[model samples]
Target: MGSPKRGHHHDLYQIEASLKEILSLLSEVEIDHKVLFLNADAGFDSENLRQMLEKEKIISNIKTNLRNNKTAKNYYYFDEELYKRRFNIEKANAWLDSFKALFIR
Candidate 1:
């Protein structure tokens, strides 16, 4: 999930509510143990979401840009190798853009 752009007024509570609903649906399907790695495009950096994921005991590998003033004081685990794999998403996006359908109005 992408975070709202800076200066855009968005309610984080709404996003959290939607995330809860989605999680509930997934749980109803008997998916109890799932490694949900959330990758954001340097925009969806929210400590609240991270806390929520931790509270639910879900393993998340979320990317956080360190351009902001806020810093992480606690030790957090991250998969550097898996983070490298995120480049594939960009490659896939580029491949999709090669299709004329994506460019058409």
Candidate 2:
């Protein structure tokens, strides 16, 4: 979900917009008895996103952004093991970058 951010805008804004589109697509598709999860960086952490994931029954593995409040206790559960697998997604994106011409068009 990472992309070039213009100016100082936060990633949460982009993710929020994308979520609507994603949920719409999900509604059009029929997924039966499958566990769904979302992996995102700390930059995308927010209570709003947490609520959205909760409502959709999607397991959220977003890292906590401790820059603002380092002493706050996170009530939300995070699975480090699953988050580690996010690198595989990054690798896939990196591989896709090699074919920039295909996407640019």
Candidate 3:
């Protein structure tokens, strides 16, 4: 994680580097199966990131965040049912937030 700074840090800012790190760790762990999907929020929606995930054979289930360009949504595929499952991840994060001392440096 990056240092706590004065302003907000967008998730997409370091996504490529972070994804590389995660892929390396996954390789080390030897998961024995392919990573099929990457369920993320709108903050992670980007053409570059989608291409990277596609290269790894992982389908991105990120929400549409057009940011003013509505036509961009047509280029991506979003699964509403799969996206709903993302709430579980949020719940886990919320639980972790209760232990902020361990996570927030």
Candidate 4:
């Protein structure tokens, strides 16, 4: 979900705004199963985001830069198989395009 922050004020991540959005999105998600993990790509690798997700009891499996395995304070276990899944955004988008309901909105 990384994007050039579309608002006039520019930053890679406005920490406060990102926090609010995380909380809001968490609230909206109704978990039917035990939600043990939240996987994100290296772009989302951040200590702040990891800590927040920790507090909420979700395992933050954010991929790190090849040299930054220690940045997130050793709290997460990097699953290579899961991290590899983030590389196929185009396939996921194509799958979504196959669903007619996604075009309705």
Ranking by TM-score: 3, 2, 1, 4
Model 4 vs. true fold: TM: 0.57
Q: Give candidate 4 regions above 4 Å deviation.
A: 1-12, 15-29, 32-34, 66-75, 88-90, 94-105
How far is 67's C-alpha from truth in model 4 (Å)? 5.9
User: What's the TM-score of every candidate structure?
Assistant: 0.58, 0.76, 0.77, 0.57
Question: How high is the CA lDDT of each candidate model?
Answer: 0.66, 0.77, 0.79, 0.65
lDDT of 2 by residue, 1-105 (tens): 234557887677677668767776666675531258888889878888888888778888888898854877666688988888899988998898979978788
Using TM-score as the measure, the top candidate is: 3
RMSD each, Å: 4.8, 3.3, 3.5, 5.1
Candidate 1 residue lDDT tens string, 1-105: 233345755445466776787787777887774566665544555677778877877776766557642566644566778878889987998788788776685
TM-score of 3: 0.77
**Which predicted model would earn the best lDDT?**
3
Candidate 4 per-residue lDDT over residues 1-105, each given as its tens digit: 333466566232675566556566656785322357766777677777777667767777777755566454565588889767766866788788788676786
Q: How do the candidates rank by lDDT, highest first? A: 3, 2, 1, 4
State each candidate's clash count: 0, 0, 0, 0
**Candidate 3 C-alpha error for residue 21, in Å:** 0.2
Error of 1 at 53 (Å): 0.2
Report the C-alpha displacement of residue 15, candidate 1, in angstroms.
Answer: 2.5
